[model samples]
Target: MTESKLRDIRWIFILLAAYFALQVGVRLATSHSLDLDEAEQVFRSQWLAAGYGPQPPFYNWLQYTVFQITGVSLAALSVVKNLLLFISYLLYGLTARLVLRDKALVAISTLGLLTIPQMVFEMQRDLTHTVAVFFSASIFFYGFIRSLKQPSLASYLIAGIGIGFGLLAKYNFAILPAAALIAALADARLRPRIFERRLALTAAVALIITLPHLFWLKDNLDFATARTLEKMTASDNASYPMQVAMGVSSLALAVISFAGLTVAVFATVFGKKLRSALAAQSEWTRLLERMMLVFLTGILLLIVFGGAAGIKDRWLVPMLFIVPLYFCLKIEAAGEETDKAFRRFMPIVTVIMIGVPAALYGSVATARFSGHYERLNRPYAGMLEILRKQAEPAAILAGDSLLAGNLRQDIPDIHVLSMDYPGFKPDISGRRPLLLVWLIPHKGENEALPPAMAQWLRANLGVSAPEALVIGVPYVYGRGDDSYRFGYAWVHPPS
Candidate 1:
């Protein structure tokens, strides 16, 4: 690399470093709020023996790689988190360079990805969304850029590889080809010649990449739908209006997310002069303009509830390049000068990029520490305390539904059992004394065990009906009717 070019890369690295420093410093300084998904990721990853469960294998693959590199410590995971964050930024940088030819505009777009709050946080968590987003951006960037240059076999082959990786990352990634094809078709000047032998090769490459995942799915036929069904039915969704509004905001937010593709899409599609102007531009710029339209349409499809949860906003993160590319196109059209519109939107983007997420997560972290909401998990230390106190070899114990999992984790050899199931009782004829842990204590349920929980406890725990059990209150909480109560601990027999 030339000296000046080396300096430019260094500048990009510094900005990315600053973004990551903020992410980890804030995550550590405030309290650690364990997202259930992240904890479950830790729980699952540790026990992972590869191909043992449902869901695609890539996330486990990525997390396992991180663990191997970092040596299984919390600090190591933190390092891994930052490492993934850096990789996401690097992919965005490459995507920007490919989509926006202007060096300055490309740098700014790179910054835009670096500071996106949703983008930043997604890296810290164990969600598969970031990797999906990375390949999604990659496929869009490489496919159209190649279409412009020479349409060489190698170029199409690379684009095909990107598409395949994207499919592995997310099911939604298939939208890219559909949107790109539609946009290309509309451009009469380009469509006929564009879909030549090379495009067919691209498709073939993607199919080749998708084959392994297809076979894996074939093996876990029931598990795929089973897992999808679980997430779909996980909870009762809210009112229709709220779901609709959420979908709208999530779709619309894509505009502000990185480069505000909405502005570019409107300028190109509805802007009175974009098509005429595009015909006169250099070939590479024309290719980029075509991509902006294609990418923007993909955003619209997402707003249409294209496999969205219809709730989580960051689900749209995979399409980060849309607006940035759009903004860059508009800037290029305006002779690389900062226009009035650019000036107006830039600060808003910056603030929303950094400020919004910090405020939202900051409030959530504060609320958690302040006892504003009920947490489903019991303290690991508290569980350990109870185990040490009860200290008996082969102790027969039962835990609330949640406790059974960690109880086994924290005290493996104990005859730990569940009160959630029917006739699950102590191995009385065995040597361990009986004890119970409520990994999750619900006040109302504990105060008066539900008939199901009560019967299960009585029949399986070797306890008498009703009041014969002495319960120890563990965690405190507020009920639905605005009441405070404790989820108490229980001893099967009131000895």
Candidate 2:
């Protein structure tokens, strides 16, 4: 590598460090509570199993490993996520260096990733799609670029590992390989590369890595896939036409939101000279750009057809990791003005990098005084204590996964069972009591136990009138006057 290239790589790391520091500072100042997604991974990591519930095992396995290494706490969880995100940023930069040789354009493409709200803002708080899958997707894309450049056994093997592990991280990873196949078929130059002996080895490696999880998935009755499908096909009161319209709009919004970030970066870095840059690229360079287009288009179509309700915008976050590079390659400046534009834009980029975290920190810090707490701001400590005192039960019966996950994380040695998904029927032998719990936000009025929890109590414990207790927990930063309410019911062992 040229000394200049080395210096650019160094700058990327420095910027990454600064970004991570900002994230950590915001987390500490706000005493950020773990979101359901974040808490769920930490909770799942507590147990070392090939499979858990209806989700892929790799994320949980990774979490469990981290917890074991660092010990479990909210801080430890944040650290793990930060490290994963940092690795993703590095992988993306390295891949950009490989594909786009222009140093200024590469730097802008690498740092510009944070401009996407989903990449930095949403990811800092989310554990699954944003953290785990983001890292895996980054690896997959890096390997993909290398393999496409040179279809050697080593490159193909790296790509295969990326595919296998990415799938293990999240099922959506299947989209990457599917996109590759479609892109190759469309590009005559790349089509023959897919039939190579080493590419076959790529498939074998992925299959081998994924084999154990496949067995576990089968043995568990493929709960993960079934649950995912159920979620997609969940009943909706809206007419079919309405559902289609809503799905189409949501899909469009997600794509546009992503594209807007790239467009902004391109405009700032290349300005009016962008068209010339595209016209000047070699055919090979342009082919790589089209591959990204093919990949995203394929993934977008699949998601739209799935018809899932309230499809999380975060699901599309991975598709954008390499998109900044994709756009830069297409619209990079042909003249030295590219350097001048980037220099002028540095201040603006810095402002964006700092302003986003400051805004998030401000919103969270003010929520306590406003008496309106988002889910992450709600206090969990007092509720955990109340559940312990009232039930002193052997296990925690959580009404939802988020509540259950936090309970498990905060209170050690307690087996948290979800009433919403009662897959665990602990043996009646020894007859241990269960602490049934749920969160009822501070909405001015006293909330009753959820109907589902009430039904579960009656059906399982034959105690329809379980004791109702409301415990008040102050918000993380709340004055004594501001707090959250928890409704709990203690159920005795079955008679």
Choose the strongest candidate by lDDT.
2
- For each of the candidates, give the backbone clash count: 6, 0
Candidate 2, overall lDDT?
0.71
Worst 10 residues of 2 by lDDT: 330-339
lDDT of 1 by residue, 1-495 (tens): 246644555667676677666666655553332344344334344443324344455554566677556544334445556665576566556556655545666666666553444554455543444544564455545655555444677767777776776666555566666556665676676676466878888788888877877787777768555664455323347555555565566555544654343444335332544444444454344555565566556555543544333334454554444545545555566454434434544555566558644863565445434656534323443545554674553553343433444444445445455553323344544444455433324444545434555565566555654432333423323223332232333343333
In model 2, which runs have C-alpha deviations exceeding 4 angstroms?
1-4, 150-152, 219-222, 226-245, 275-281, 296-312, 333-336, 386-393, 425-433, 442-451, 454-465, 491-495
Q: lDDT tens digits, residues 91-168, model 2?
A: 888788877767777887788787777876777655564577778878877777777775567778878887888878
Specify the highest-TM-score model's number: 2
Where model 1 places Cα greater than 4 Å from the true spot, the runs are 1-6, 46-55, 68-73, 99-101, 114-117, 120-132, 139-161, 181-210, 219-222, 226-312, 339-361, 368-370, 373-378, 385-442, 447-495
Q: Candidate 2's error at 81, in angstroms? A: 1.1
